[model samples]
Target: MLRELPVALYCGAFAGMTSPLVAGSYSFIILAGLMSGIILAISKTSFHGFGGKLGTIAFGGVCCVSLIIYILN
Candidate 1:
């Protein structure tokens, strides 16, 4: 878990930055980080090292954050 932290944080940071471009706010950025961290944390335990899982988590993090933000607004 400790080893994965940097990678997870990097993914969260990437998700946080890109989410704002599509959704347009710091709120979305926060949501993206939260969702990305949670999703990646959950997935890590089950991951089989298939290609692109990290990217997929990043995308899903941004998308879910966008959706949640839209719903809240």
Candidate 2:
């Protein structure tokens, strides 16, 4: 179970680095995280062997949350 700790820590670091102004709130952060996780899962093979894949995934996650917030507000 603990074998995935490093990946979890890396994901958490990406989330933690998000600015408060952009993240807006803790809930938003959580939502962005979920979005990123979904993106990562769906894109497991699509981006294989590419550099900055995690960063791209993180950016995609933030963008998704931003779009959601934009549409709702």
Candidate 3:
């Protein structure tokens, strides 16, 4: 949906910046965006109002990546 575009883009940009490689970053961003969109649509409720879903997704993604790095090192 048009409403979700900005959220997706923002998430994608955040992922790309934090990720190690460009290609992999884009993939991660797209996957995160898709997952977030699906969850938001299915939930039918917003936790923090508009764009909250996307923020949650982005935060989750960052946390996951951080955990991965911590475990790997």
Task: Give the higher-TM-score candidate: 1 or 2.
Answer: 2
For model 3, give the RMSD to the true fold.
4.9
Q: Candidate 1's C-alpha lDDT?
A: 0.79
Judged by whole-model lDDT over C-alpha atoms, candidate 3 comes out at 0.56
- lDDT tens readout by residue for model 1, 1-73: 5887898888876786583359687777777878988998788777696887777888898888778767988
Give the winner by lDDT: 1 or 2.
Answer: 1
**TM-score of candidate 1 on Cα atoms, chains taken together:** 0.78
What tens-digit string does per-residue lDDT give for candidate 3 at 1-73? 7886776676545545545542245555565555545554655454655555556666666556555556986
TM-scores for candidates 1 onward, in order:
0.78, 0.82, 0.42
Question: Residue 57: error of model 2 in Å?
Answer: 0.2
Whole-model lDDT values for every prediction:
0.79, 0.78, 0.56
lDDT by residue for model 2 (1-73), tens: 4785565556655765788889878888888888887877788669668788777787888889999899999
Best of the two (1, 3) by lDDT: 1
Q: Kindly report which residue stretches of model 1 are placed more than 4 angstroms away from their true locations once superposed.
A: 17-20
Candidate 2 stretches greater than 4 Å from native: 1-5
TM-score of 2: 0.82
In candidate 2, which residue pairs clash?
none
